[model samples]
Target: MFLTNVLNESDCQPIKKSYDQWYTFMDKNVEFWLPDSELHTKNHCARVLLLALLIGHQKGLSHEEKDTLGMAAAFHDSRRLNDGVDKGHGIRAAEYYKDFCREHELPYDVQTYYITSYHDQDDSFGLSEITNSPVVRERGVLLYKIFKDADALDRFRLGPNALNVNMLRTEEAHRLVDFAKDLLQKSNETNS
Candidate 1:
């Protein structure tokens, strides 16, 4: 996939650096994540990053936008370390990003704030309400949409036997159902 290729590319230094830092952080704090009994460790954050990259590539986002999306995806779930009950993970993530920017000597901007805040929004929050807000519906908002859809796609991989049907109630979740079914079929054929 082009998204996979883009992720693999070494030229995107900022995205690569943030991803490395986040992965290292996650490795040291894996126990903080919500438990899922499934065989996969259920690193929703990593999956969300991958999904965001895929969606960004598929949507033909500009290079700068892709990097911003990637950074947002990498840090969006960092607040999960504290049990994720607090409704301000986005703000927390933004604070982390501020630290990151200072350490890396990177430029700070409103896009970073928008990306972090929107990415951390509760999934149950209605898209219509989000879209109705000017700040929430700007170009930066597209990054969150891509991440949201991609995260939904990964969750859909849990088949009917493994997941509650109610999990796929959202429009994006329902859309991913078909894609997940196809991927499952392909995997089965390969295994057989």
Candidate 2:
């Protein structure tokens, strides 16, 4: 899948450079992942990054927050072995995240690692009960929510039943769900 150019110029600018680097990395490392999985490709990562940026921007997060989310988005699934609910891929990806950061001398904090590692485990979609839980509230909650929502928004790629807008965590994410769906539809049509 190719990266979608659906975002506005302002929204795309910050992520463009990172995505450019990610695209090259993905092309080089394509053989490390499941090539045909709708849910775990570099294109999905790009979409997630876009979604994370939109949500973070809507919530008035800092540039650092957005950039961290971008990093989590890009490497969230870098270590996936298969598409069938591989339970520990997040941990593996987190490990790869560390290596990637160190190898490229990129800056990252522990929170970014937590966000990437836990992104797949919680699909709370921002339910107050879950969001209020100690685990989520402890650290990186905002970025975690943004990452989770960004990843969930892409569930449209998994088909209609896969996405539940109400399950989305933030108001902005709920509002953008349909648009995400539209992007998936358009992407499919293009690929078709």
Candidate 3:
């Protein structure tokens, strides 16, 4: 509701454009590839993308950075097979992203690749743990943080294991937890 209201009322064309493009891309190239998993769906990706853009913008990231984060959010679960403890879904998603970008001839950044590759890694749940990696630090630690929190914000789909506000790394993400959960619940109700 918050995202919809903001996008509906705001004149941020680039964010709106990126948002629309992501949906189109998902519908055209990714949705059909999804399995029967309930947690990793177009709806989940939409929430993650919205959260990423919201938190990334709050961090005052550049337009390019926001775009990369959006892309990462869109593709983060593209390779998910089941909702169970799929430890390496991020890695699989990254590989799928590489192939998707290559086949579509889309321009991509290494930072986005790293963010997508490790978004699901539990180590990424905290800023300190994520920054311990020199590669992510040098490339895009903030990007990774935003992506991770954005992904985490959607954990309401996990029911009892839903994301807690305290677990969100970014302050902005923490603030959005309630709204995200509300949206998630509404989505669930509608789906049910």
Candidate 4:
């Protein structure tokens, strides 16, 4: 209700959630593929999840929608084979999410599955794939874009020039540029 009103009325204010707050919430609900890897682990996922929620809020996403982002963030990279360009890692992660849901008897969210399945893929294919899924057809594009931008925001660990501001999908994501950098700095994470 508040998010709906906020979106209808005016721009949403930016929010900064404590990194430690999010980091400590990492429950290892689903074990990461490279748990010990400095590149892809709970820490990286925490940062991406934080960015996704913050971006979702700035975009006035409903609580349910933000929850979807959280789900995506939690399992998107859990099946990675390595730190390098793991071509099908996203799909593997998506399958893992699906299997986990089935095993746990939890409601599966298709949108999160799609977002996880395509997170490592090119934007063109990712966007196209989302359009074909009626489950998320209404807002899948926006959600996918937000997830991508959130993941990209953490690219600061890749190097200084890893993230391009112009490439960001949403204005809110663009606005969080400096915050992303600062968060990455405080986290002391660097991709190898």
Q: Per-prediction count of colliding residue pairs?
A: 0, 2, 0, 0
True-structure RMSD for candidate 4: 6.4
Considering TM-score, which of the candidate structures 1 and 2 is the better prediction for this target?
Answer: 2
lDDT of each: 0.54, 0.72, 0.74, 0.79
Best by lDDT: 4
- Candidate 1's residue-wise lDDT over 1-192, tens digit each? 112333354433335544455445545533323345231232445555554554565567777776676566656656554543456766777777777777778776556566666654555463444566665436755665665565556554455554443643344444455554544454344435
Point out the worst 10-residue segment of candidate 2 by lDDT: 122-131
Question: Residue by residue across 81-149, what tens digits does model 4's lDDT show?
Answer: 989998999999899989998998988989989999999999999998899876775888999999999
Order of quality (lDDT): 4, 3, 2, 1
Off by over 4 Å in 2: 1-4, 8-32, 123-139, 190-192
RMSD of each: 7.2, 4.2, 3.5, 6.4
Model 4 compared with the native: what TM-score?
0.85
142, model 3: CA deviation in Å?
Answer: 0.4
Tens-digit lDDT track of model 3 for 116-159? 87877775353454466565645388788788888888887788
For model 4, the superposed segments whose C-alpha errors exceed 4 Å read 1-26, 189-192
- lDDT score, residue 51, model 1? 48
Ranking by TM-score: 4, 3, 2, 1
Clashing pairs in 4: none
Report the lDDT tens digits of candidate 2 across residue range 78-191. 789888788778778888888877887877566677777777675553334345555543537777877888889999787778987777778889888777887677656656
lDDT of 4 at 6: 23
How big is the positional error of residue 19 in model 3, measured in Å on the Cα after superposition?
1.3
